[model samples]
Target: MNEIILKFSKESPQVKDTPIEISVIDVQPDYLYKFNAGIDGIWTTIQDFSEENFCIWKPKIDGKYTLMIQGKKKDGKKSFDAAAKADYIIGAVEEDIIQSVNIDRRELLQGEKLSVMVETTVKPVMYKYWISGKDGWELIRDYNSENEFLFTANEPGKHEILVECKTIESKNNFDDFRTISFIVSEIEKVQITDFKCLSTELLTDKELIFQVDARHEDSRMVLYKFVKIDNKGKALCIQDYSSKRMISFTEREPGSYKLLCMAKDMYSTEDFDDRAIIVYDIKPYKPIVIKSFTTDFTSPQTTGTKILLKAMVEGGRNLLYRYMIEGKHGEDSGFIRNNSFLWETKYPGEYKLSLYVKDESYSGDYEECTSLEYLVEEKLFKPVKIRDVALSKDKNYVKNKPINITVSADGGNELRYSFIVYKDKEEVEKINFGIANWVNFTPEQSGEYELEIRVRDKYSHKDYDSHTFIFFNVRDYIPGIIDYILIPSKEYYMVEDDIEIEVITQNAKETLLKYCISINGHPVESTEYSKVKKFKFTPKVSGKYNLEIYSKNIQCKEGYDEKKETKIYIHEALPVTNTKIKSSLVKAKRNEEVTFVVNSEGGKDVCYEFYLMEEENWKLVQRYSKKNYYTFIPFISGTYRLLALSRSFYKKVSYEDYDIFKLEVN
Candidate 1:
């Protein structure tokens, strides 16, 4: 039993000149299909030379088409004329079709990317995209099957994106077009957050504390500055810009004061990222007096190390505080709201740490500060002692190859090493005690060698603090190339034929091979050293070419092995195009023999195979061989469908060309 099914690349309602693919599915045994199409019940044969199951075609006229598939079976004495048909319509081309275009965002900042997609009634054949920015129009993408694109907003201004769509078989540049516009702005600026006065009283004698908070994108660092403006509008610097957002100060001549606080990003390019102002009047208040200032820290600490100072005050309100370090590395902590500080210095000596406190507003720079003595002893590091020197010297070392030596030591803050190489009894190379602890030494000549490593800290003054040594040997190598051969052993080389190279080697460890080419005794090209065992060379043009190959050891100073092939001729190639299948009889009786022959053109050493698609799968009637003919005899009554496939001996693919033929046995 046999049933036919048809599949098309495009559905009905297609227009003229639209390419379409048709596939026939007949899995039943002894079945093959013949395709034909027409408008009415009567169908005309379609002249398409394709596979027995598939074909491609384009409709030239606009109308409805009825496609018919005639099926047959390869057997004896049974009628196998099973048939199936399908309908396809060719509609008129419609103009002014609508397309859908959408964008991810309408507004964005410069340096951001936007996504857009276009949609139509059917899949378009091609799409073109263009972007219009401050620099006029630019083609973003050319004709392609993609419906989406990512547009980058590099300029700060109005921008537009245009997309053109083309459906199947359309000749115009675009069948439908759509556009979208967007606006891109610059980077966001900073703004001043809320500012608060932490002090209880605004008086001249008392300490006043002010804290400002601001942030632009949480992870960005913000620095703050505080300035005081008098009644005369003249600005005086209270505290310069710093990462600390709190400040404490005492105003002696306090009247009407306007405080300006500004916040900015640490790396912001603007004058001020954000700013805020505060207006207030100062009145006379009680003087600030330090009652009992307590501090905690282990003294006699090492220099060049960070130490924390934990401080607590019992003064007025402790609303404002300041710290000053007096020594070789002096620094002022400026008036801040925090009481503790971290100090570090490279110099070691006597030092004094002082802290001043105030309650609220200030009158003058009087006293409310306490001092603490610190003994910063010099930090000493131990001399570098050689611990372990690891090396892989058991393996044979060849001349001219690099030897790497590395050493590790203990008990040094900053250690330096000196590598000394000795050949025989004489010194060859040496690096002074520097930060480098690893070195590579290449032996220029075969010899007995010794490597010595010495390590010392920067503070050590002796000739060496710790030393170690190792011994190794280097040996010379011999180079030789035995022979080489070319594939396809042809007298005349073709212009487009691939030739393989096979090389045999002797004492081949670390041997480098080079391929040199020349034309008529003039050198044209030479390749670098490689271990090429399976190299393919394809000739592009016909010429009298000379090919030379050489092998040598990279570690050896001079000797090499060479081979050459001279004055080889290359000719143009002939291409295999197709094969034609012919049959002796179109109809035959039961048990009658049928003969089929295949003919080929421009083929080189061609071979043929005969196959029959009579059932669920094709059965091989004849395997690939030099004989170009096939003989067939049928038993069960049906039709015989034979396919001939031809391939060249040198071709890598399965078959170059094929043809189908039919024979009916009644």
Candidate 2:
């Protein structure tokens, strides 16, 4: 006999008035269980355990009791097999009450299930529920040992529920109670959303079926009515109100007709919840569907390679297929009934293959069409791009200077050109290809610049037919004076001479030459600077004149390109034009008292200086003075020469004119 043992977890002594569940871990399926309690060393059967459920016990008084379970032989009689017992202490009255009561659904529509669950602070408690619904307050459920209840919401309105729970051994009405409110909405009327017919599906002779779509929240039985409306404004009932959602007809009428459907619940209050109508034009039926027209191709093969391209036709009768495949090096397009085509790919590039299909009896262009991408290639040849062409010019470059580029292309077709400029290895400007064969560019900064010129035919498919580039550099711009010229080259300039001073400048392109001229320590003619490269002036009086030239570029403000100064003397014309030495004799003896006076024309306060030749040397007979005449007496002279010089009273250029005379003494 196996020893029987009872496991009691009600220790630390459970409440006296509370019920405890007694369950046995080891029990035979063909046995009846008997639960007993010990009273003064004697075991008394307190409750009988059913095979379907465990036995529950509620202690009447506080005491130490032994709880035991006996395994029996049959369901009717007690044939003891093994017994197990566990001692338990029953304290005073236990206040096992409900901890919380909650309704699983807070709001629901009619015909939906709502559950109320009750939880207690301890197990083995009784729950009861009272509901105030559309029928007013009533005891919906009596007290039960179960902790929850589920029921369908039949009535519509705000339903208030009251739940109460108490210990199984408690004699009181309730230990705890809770109140909760929820609303049960009325069942929504059924709405007929749409009436549909599968026109593409095949049916038997004179057979038609349309599906009806309806919406509702109620679980009640629904009925749908179908009506047939002809183009003549006549209506006929095709289907009466029934539980069927689809209507079937055997009418072979071949005119335009409207099919209408009305849907509603069996117990709805309205005449018809919702009605839907669909226009149907009945005609002789023939089905043709080009579900998909697809093309299949294998990888590319070498030259003279034959590729079998197939067109996949899914659904259609007597369908004709057409194919078109195109690439740069090869292309094929044809229309045929055969599903496969043999293609020889001569190009090595990406290709797109299109397949089109149409039913023989169909009037439309095509029923279905699809495209496929495949390539037939060999070892890839070099890319024949538009390159190795160049645009060049033999010239120096400067900043902010514009230059023109002329493309020299020998293509047979119309040409186009594009220009791109890069400064310091970075692109700064670009012009796209167009019909024009020339491009103009301006350098913006001083650096290494590259101009790339690309050309192509106007209708060429490639990016360009030829392209070339040239590298060049730009030097920094600094204004400079080239040179200056004094017009009319001459030894000396008279006081009234019109002097032309022309200055030249070597500055940046598009930069003008501004001149600032000054003479005699003052700004002359043009005090302000201007674009005056050539300046002319007439000096009224004779004086030493200072000529200064300042040339500058327009981009500068404070300084000039170069500063140049030159000194020029402008004198008055010779005032004394003719002068002569007048003597009493051409030859005179020593101390002969020869009177040699200077007589001159065109003179004013003239001062004369006299000189005589003696011993192969000229000697001054008298210094310059206000005296115009002089006395000459030769002392020892074989042949004597006397000279007279005259000038203006001011004698600006020493002496303007002079005369010489030959005198002899014998």
Candidate 3:
């Protein structure tokens, strides 16, 4: 292969519009050659020549570009290829010479000298200086080698200084120059005539106004500055510059302070005039209070009344009021923002009512608490009397039974009772019942007895007591012969089965009493009988039953009869032997409907119950009485049973029979 290569005179990055020379080596003669240049990595044909070895390229825009050259024979065969790349950055055609300038001061009084100097990084071939004042810029130095100059400002205004230079590389370039400005004004003299506050003595957090009076030689604007001098003679600026004549300041610390006021013109060699000082004395704050307090009502107030309580406080911005009654804080007492409150009286007595007042200043150190005693007299109550007294039971009671006694009274809030029991006109027992109205007593022996109840109001005197009495007969109590009975003698029983219920007695005293028997809640028989009481009962239907037995003697009272109850269970009996169901298939698909017909020895009124198998238990699905057959579709694959129950129209006993069927579902 014939190889082609490209070379450049300068490999460094070139500025825009700068020319670069490129040469192509090892070129094949009389063969087609192409030179390509890329802008931002894209290659394009720049020139296509047959035998050229060198080319000039000047980039107009600044960027990185790739240059490529390729050569081939006229028959379209590859011969040589070369490439070169460089970056081009934008730059000025000439270098910048002016760096910076320096001046002694920017502000000066009239007739003051000003010094200015110029500096440059590159050596300049020429230098020029000028000054701009009331007239246009006047040439002060032309083509001078020295870069520094001095001038005086006689007029009061702004003046501009300019310096122009040229580098040795480009002498015709005058674009590089440095300019600076300064201000000059006439001097003025001022003095402070008076500096005094409204009051020299002040309390903490109190404001004082300080007025300044000054005179100026020139009719220029004057400024006032206030400085505070501590006990150590250190000055601190309170107000820097204020055009106003008076200023207000508040002292927050207890100390002695010296306030100095200075007056000066807008432009002066001396910064401030003779300052006038004022001494101030600040003292710690002490709150003032007036202790005049009063209430809406006087002493000896009636019980159960509402009274208004108030405190008139003066000379405090934030005041707190608290109230108490008889050493107990009232409900409206803690930190009250208001001064007045309502007090509801509770009991009839003398009470100490107190009021505590405080100001929210200085951590509530200044507080005033005062107390006064008041009397609450009791209201007169009417005399009370016993209206009626009653008993829970009849006055004639058994000898050993307890009786409840209660009383009704009028015109009193509280009452007392005294219960006394007497026998044969002699006191047996006396009970001080206190505030209770009822008492229970048991007479030891059967005899004539009397019960007396005395009642009195809580506020009644001994002469106001009332008494009442009732005569009662105590009778002897007799015991029963039989206590209870237990039936079936087992946990459960079956229907149509003969069950013997045993009768049990307290002492086996059968000859002294008459016995009555009831089974299934119906009376069976009653007689003066033996102890065994032999009887047989057969339940017709499957269910639960209750058996009751009562024993009584003719000589005993009517309520002295003893009774007992027993619960029994009777299970269902199997149906007749010949009862069955006729089905087409013993096992069928779950989605298919199966029919069952009842087949029995004799056709009669029968109810059919269908049960499905669910979780090891049989669940009744449906029951029908008017139809002899049942049809159902099983949703789940399982075993099922059908119960055929028959009962005669005149008898309560029912007979049942069941058959199982299996099913499968896909």
Candidate 4:
């Protein structure tokens, strides 16, 4: 029997063919072969030159197992095979291990597309390239078959491309793979480096300066837009600048505004970068214009009335406005020196009103003038004046006489005069004379009379000019005083009541006098009065009598007699004192304590009887008692009376009085 040997670069003891000493080149091969029988007719050869090294072995038992290597002939495959049987096993390993998976890009920008090229060297396209965490590797353009793969980055992030390669084997299959890491960073659509305002003064024809930077892994022509904001802060239409470094906004109107700069790559229109700037227009401020001026009432009377004038301006201008009044006499200043003015006229005349307005920012004098014409007349509503006022008592009046008043006015129209005669600022008489030259008034009552006579012109409205005088009313000077004194008595008189009232006068005075007699303050008209002064009367109702006499002269002046009273007490029998007691709810709770009191009908401490009665027929609580007062308390709730019978000190005074009282205890 003969044995065969195989060799490998690294040891694998599972194989039977072991070689004693194997060459480094022959140890790892594209394929391995084995034999164990005597040689019949097999020959070994390297069929194709595909891998770096292709080995063959023809083991035959002509005498023993033998090896043959087929590689480059000059390298002497026979010499290497003879040494393999001594020490090496037939194991194979790949010579080319994947060192790394290399990618073209490391970082990518957002919304940017980039083509990535993958490079690797392994036999027979040993490794399939894959973008890790995604499906199979996507080929962008087929160049160099699958040996080189191309892909575009869709997102910005770190990514891995995995390369898996396998080496062919005779007995045990073996493979090797590795991963390459890459990053995709965010990218700007436009490359505007210096997007800023060049100068604020040139904002009307504003110029924007910007620069595009080509620092990305991919180069692309980009479109940029420069937008300017109006004074209202609204974004205007975007202005396109193709690959331009400077954008100008000369088409914009004059004002302060802002500018926004953005950029877009020709490939990706969605990506943008922005910046802003401020602008101001340095134009002169225009003065506004005055439009119109007028008044509330342009026509006014000259009798001390004020005329108002108002001035208005427009067109956003500052104005100095004033009004002046010029007439035949002279020009006069008005109440206000600006805008609105008031002019007062002294008398009935024609007047001129001139309104002037000036742009104070541009000139020191007025630029606009407005004028109005006004005619003045005597006042329609003048105050009334009273003159030539006379009273019937010669203006210096006597007492209690009919007074006549006359009032007249001098100018204007015929007037309706109203006369109010007052004794002391209080109206004594009122007379309305209809459209008269003069008015007459008579005072019915005399004192110090103040006459207020007001005359209002029929055409004008006015009142109150007064003529006042003082007078006295003497009693004897009045007509009605009794000349003859008469004492008359009534034809009939009752025995208990009689009185006489007398009438006296110097002439046949028609004055009626009233006489009254009263008991206390109450009148007793039922009592008869004697017609004569010498007549007599008997008192009926026993009480004090008061006589009051009242008279007045024809002038309505009051004269009265003082009260005369006489006291009399009448007695037909002895007077006795009666008594009673009063209280509410004598039986009550502890919080509602009870109190009782006795009441009497006469003077205190008179002799009387004291009794306590629970049932009918009261018993004498005080025997033979002269005391008029007593007190008692019931132990329980019941009804009782504490009686009192009092007698007066006079011989005819004796009485019985009793108080019924109820007691309650809680």
Per-residue lDDT tens digits of candidate 4, residues 367-413? 55778786667776543444455545543344545555555555445
For model 2, the stretches where C-alpha displacement exceeds 4 angstroms are: 1-403, 409-418, 431-436, 442-449, 454-492, 496-526, 531-546, 551-568, 572-579, 587-591, 599-607, 614-618, 634-638, 645-658
lDDT of every predicted structure (CA atoms): 0.71, 0.67, 0.64, 0.47
Return the TM-score for each candidate structure.
Answer: 0.23, 0.30, 0.25, 0.22
For TM-score, candidate 1 versus 2, the one ahead is 2
* lDDT (tens digit, per residue) of candidate 1 on 406-523: 7888766777789888998689988888887788888888878877787766776655656666666777864455455545677657777887666667556666777777665456
Per-residue lDDT for 1-666 in model 2, tens only? 455645554653566678787777766777767788874455678767556325778887654566777776664344677677665656543354667778877888766789888777787777878776433345678788887889777778887777766777877556666667899888877877767885443323455778987787555788888888988989999777887787666555556888888888776656678898888776434444443333222343334444556554555557677777767765545557897777776666788877777766557867777776765567332211232333344455667777666655553356677888887667888889777767666777777787777765577565554555666666455565646545567777777789887766664342345444444444554445566667777888766777766666666577666667667777665468768777788667776777787877765677888888877898888888879777756677588788888887765566888999887886
Model 1 residue runs over 4 Å out of place are 1-419, 424-448, 457-549, 553-603, 607-636, 641-662
Per TM-score, the best of the predicted structures is 2
Order of the predicted models by TM-score, top scorer first: 2, 3, 1, 4
- Model 1 TM: 0.23
Q: Could you tell which candidate, 1 or 3, scores higher by TM-score?
A: 3
Global local distance difference test of model 2: 0.67
Per-residue C-alpha lDDT of model 3 across residues 372-391, encoded as one tens digit per residue: 78766664543344556677
